[model samples]
Target: MATLAAECDRFKIDVIGISEVRWNGTGEFTNQKGGVLMYSGMPDEQDPHIRGVAVYVRKNVKHSILCWKAISERIIVVRFRAKKFNMSLVQCYAPTEDSPLDQKEVFYSALERTLSEIPRTDVIILMSDFNAEITQSIELGSLFPHKTCHKVTWKSPAGNFESQIDHICISKRWSKVLCDVRNKRSADIDSDHYLVVAELKFNIPKHRYEHPQHTRRTYNTTKLNVGAVKNEMIERINNVSLMEDASIEETWLHIKTNLEEICKDTLGYRKNEQKEWLSANSWELIAQRRSLSRQIKKAVKSDKRNYYVELSMKAQAASEKGDMKELFKLTKQLGGISFQSSAPIENENGQLVFAKNEQAEVWKRHFEKTLNIIHNESGELTIPRHLNPNRQIDTRAPSVNEIRGVIISMKSGKAP
Candidate 1:
């Protein structure tokens, strides 16, 4: 997934649809590089992993996503908020023509229902493996003139036959925005199908309203451990001037300002430090492979193949030597998979809340309802005179010596 995302980034593509995901279940997650991958697969645990569909949107495009639905393993739809009219993308994995008629009917019936649910004003883009060849349709067909090689999307195992099974169809109302559609054969992902790319001449407008992001400044508090720094801070605080007849609030404001100024001058902000794990040699190999990937000649393909073999060997060697850190890093880089935090929580109406302020509001309402309970059956209890204690407890503040003893008994090197 990471490798595919990197390829999309290289081509400057904001969104891409994928078929045959084959992963179990349906959900969405963000990759380490910040790209969002929303996939739908077989919902049943007993079902075989097959015919899954997914859509990947780049980091910048993710903010515009309004909502998404996982209809089934072979169908998924994602809606995006756009400039004039919102855009809806439906990715599908249709059954082949040779499949049973009933199976094909089921797929088309579900697809029709999904399309009907979308608003008519939306500009829908239906894409991915349809497994059918049609010369005409309501959706705009590929009209750009290109070589036969650029039109073929899939090849037979023996490399004797080729076909264009994958396609990208846009609503006729907005068909003028589609500039061209072509197949890119140089993109090698160990699949018989080539990468189908579409060029659209349109702009995605900025969000309606953007919340200002406030970044909290973090000071290097460890500097306070230095004797000179500590002394300078204390001296600055002691030298602060205050009005003799100032109110309590005014005095507190003056002291707070002085303390903040002292801290800013003495302690600098902390910087985020990250380690570079890849060695120089690995980077060189990666660069060479990337350069070779752009060419479709036989010699370049052989060189790229050799590079993959070498990288695989290096990974095996690292595993044998028990260098788990390097092994894990290599695996993430080569296997095209990375870890993500988790999915966002849904609101009361089952809609996802992405903004921090909205999420806080949801939590606030939850706590208010949960913690404030009204009692329906309540009565005052009477105390029994026979159960009362015989001795009277003293109700006096502790003396200075007792307070000192209590403080001394507490453990050291801990926060109060």
Candidate 2:
């Protein structure tokens, strides 16, 4: 029991949903430390041995128990938010005896009610030791092909069946199976049967919507704005620390991981003395820190003002010189802005919306605009001077001398 408590402490699990927490009137089990622990089947059942279900939620998560019920002698329903994704995680110990279909109906009904009671957005993770058979025909599809647990929960020394009954179910809205989320059967701890544990992965509510509509460094201009961006990246690096060293990639490759974390923060970073330990010299730590710092740099620059200011000079220069290449490059760089091919914004009104497309298309449109501007500004256009005079040159070409002048003019346009 002490070891279990220490494991829970080491993991920092937000909710420890335990089934069959056998309680005694005078044992140390009376003391529920670290979080709110709710144990059922106490005084009323005349069983001080609270045998059925229990849940311990960490204090900082800010959850009010939305609903709690003992739907079956072996099953319990709990609805709470592990940071806004309100989930209904049931603690079930399936009936040992071959109960009638009528009992199964009640268990299934409770599951249905539990799903309806919680927000659909919040996922349902049904975790239990279901001694009944886990057939493909069984209602739960989400927990299919129970990896490492393709065996029956009940073992009479003969080891008769190999179909998984102990399972965990996830609502379609809450999660999907990835290589990471897993559990395996283990020698039962403090019980006769083997134990099955699941590592469930849920989308943290604050992290789901990560992409910023606009990402300018500061709404206001000051060094503090820069710090705010830097701080946000710092927070991302902090989040990565929670993950095991093997699962994560090198710093640059995992920039998007920090993007979501960066978006969750009001300041975009966490502050601690550890951040101060980040060495400018070590590439490993530097890259890790820099990944987050890049997020801050972007947040600082992700505003309309900073965005426009950064592009203002380029936009004007592109407009003046009629160099489609540089103008297009500028447009490519400014990811979430609209621009026009002609000096008049109206010409490029619909043309200048932000969507992620290939680099070639960006350059293609940029040159098209540049060519158009060059055509309009110089009052001339250029093409291959073909003496063959093919019909492909559908329009008349300006005199070579005039076209040369236009080219020369644009080439010289970049000089201060």
Candidate 3:
């Protein structure tokens, strides 16, 4: 699986449809590198793993996946959000040509039904092992001519017989997007079939308007806790010269810029540290224990047990110390919890809004309709005249003392 992922990465493939997964049960899992693998196979209770199909999407492109359905062990379908038009991919491990006619008919009938269910506006791509040879077709045609080796998708063990059984077919409307389709013999998966790669000239449209993100530097303010650093900062501020005749704004800006420069020069930027639930020592112990377990030795077993006890002690110590962050992370890991990034939201028309500007527009429209109230009739509120007419309401501006009193009474740590 790792090798396959590496191959995909090498080729910079974002989406890959795999045939003959041969895994029991249908499910999905994020790999160590964050790539997602969605597979469909026979139920766990039913043994003797046979035909199966799957789709592997790169981590970067995982956000584009809208939904996926495991139709059967032989077929799976995944829908992806694309620019201009969405796309639906159907992966199949079709019955061999030599299989019974009934079986072949059932496979094709199911595929037909699946295709029918997909929206006609989608750019449908059907790929993987079809188990049939196509000499020529009017509706479907190969875009590029390659060497015979690059044309054959599968080969016999003896290296005598070879044919292009696997295929990647796209909707006629999107045929122009496909640049090339050929077999890649370099990808070695220890299978008789070679990897079939297809190139598509897809333009992932950006948001209509994107707010430019500016990276801000974070100074290590913690250094201020040190008496020397605090004194240095004060000394630098005292040494700064202010223009006596400059405007208030100009003077403030000069001081602000100088302070920032002094802090940057003295404190430097904070370094980001990658936090993990377990300590480095604990991870090292775990690696050593794993290495020892591979060897069949009584001494090694005893050492591994010792390492386990040490790891348990470390975890217990963390619990006693009330390290909530580490505890929660460890709990999630034990519970097999995986966190995924949020996907794009749908709009009023039930279509996904992927662009940031478009999403903002949708939100704007939603709030406008939700908050705006239309009143059929207006009612006037009548307040009785001031009860204490003799004590006239003060209409004069507040004095400096009154303003200072109000300022003193106000709470700190609040926005002005």
Query: Which ranges of candidate 2 are over 4 A from the true structure?
Result: 10-13, 22-33, 42-51, 58-72, 82-84, 100-102, 134-163, 177-181, 184-188, 203-416
Span of ten consecutive residues with least summed lDDT in model 1: 133-142
lDDT of 1: 0.82
Best by TM-score: 1
TM-scores for all candidates: the values are 0.58, 0.38, 0.49
Considering every candidate listed, which one attains the maximal lDDT?
Answer: 1
**Residue 231, model 2: Cα distance from true site in angstroms:** 54
> By TM-score, is 2 or 3 better?
3
Question: What is candidate 3's local distance difference test score?
Answer: 0.80
Tens-digit lDDT track of model 2 for 244-327 = 464455554566656554555544333322242224564365345536655765786577568678797887799799878778
Error of 3 at 105 (Å): 1.8
Report the lDDT tens digits of candidate 3 across residue range 1-416.
76677678888888899998899889998776678999999877467888989999987788788899999888999998887888899999999868999998888999999999999999999996988765432122366877776788888997657777899999998899999998877675568898999898875433243353555658999999999999998999899999899999999999999988999988988976645445678657654654564453567668877866765666677799987666655555455445453457788899987667999999899977666544444654333343333665688999999999989988654465
Q: State, as a TM-score between 0 and 1, how close model 2 is to the true structure.
A: 0.38
